[model samples]
Target: MPERAPHGTSPSHPSPEAYAALESLLRASPRGRWFLAEYARRNRTAETEMLLEAIARIERAVLKPAPRQAVPSNV
Candidate 1:
C-alpha cells in the first residue's frame, strides 16, 4: 500500500456519512465516477478502501432511519 499523507494532513478523512455523500455524488454524476476512478488510481491505499466501506455503511445507516408522520391539525 502507498504511504498516507500523514494523519489529519490528508483529505480530512471524512466521516462515514461524508463518504456516503461522496458516493451519492459520484453515482449522480457521470464525470464524478471518472474522477473517483482516476483518483483511486493515483492514490491507491488501504485508506481508500476504508473510505469506500465507510460510504456504504453511512448509506445503510441513513436509509435505515424510521419514518415519522406529521400530526393532523384540528380544523
Candidate 2:
C-alpha cells in the first residue's frame, strides 16, 4: 500500500522546486507568454469591474445629492 502524507499536508501540492521549474518552462515559450498575458488581462478586468460596482454601491448608499437652495428674490 502507498504511504499517506503527513497531517495538514497533501501530495497534490507541488514542491517549491517543482513550481519553479514549471514557472521557468512557462516563461521560456512564446505561447506561454501569450497565455500569461491573457490571464493577467482577464484578472485585471475582473478586479476593475468589481471595484466599479463597489463604488457605485457606496455612492448610492452614502453619497446622496444635496438639495439646491432657492435663489434670493429681487427687491
Candidate 3:
C-alpha cells in the first residue's frame, strides 16, 4: 500500500510558492493562459469573478497603456 501524507498535508496540495510559480508559467503561455481563463469562467464565483476583474484591471493599467502628462496651455 502507498504511504499517506501527514495529517495536515496532502500530496494534492502543493506549497504556495509552487502554486505561484505554476500560475506564473501558465500565465506566460498562450495555451495555458487560455486554459486558466476558461477554467475560471467555468467555475465562476463571486470572489473568483472579483479576482478576475481585479487582474484584468491591473493588466489593462499596466500592460495596455502609456502614461501621459498634461501639456501646459502656454507651451
Best by TM-score: 2
Better of 1 and 3 by lDDT: 3
- Tens-digit lDDT track for model 3 on 3-69? 7988998678779999999999999989999999998877787678889999999988888767699
Can you write out model 2's per-residue Cα lDDT over 1-75, one digit (the tens) per residue? Answer: 987998999778789999999878988999988888899999999999999999999988787887898888983
Provide the RMSD of all predictions against the true structure, rounded to 1 decimal: 15.7, 7.5, 13.1
Model 1, 1-75: lDDT tens per residue? Answer: 965786768545789999999799897888998898888887787778889999999999998968887878973
Candidate 1: 10-residue stretch with minimal lDDT: 3-12
- Candidate lDDT (C-alpha), each: 0.85, 0.91, 0.90
Cα distance off (Å), candidate 2, residue 41: 0.4
**TM-score of each candidate structure, all chains considered together:** 0.38, 0.59, 0.44
53: Cα error in model 3, Å: 25
Model 2: residues with Cα > 4 Å off, grouped in runs: 1-16, 64-75
Question: Rank order by lDDT, top first?
Answer: 2, 3, 1
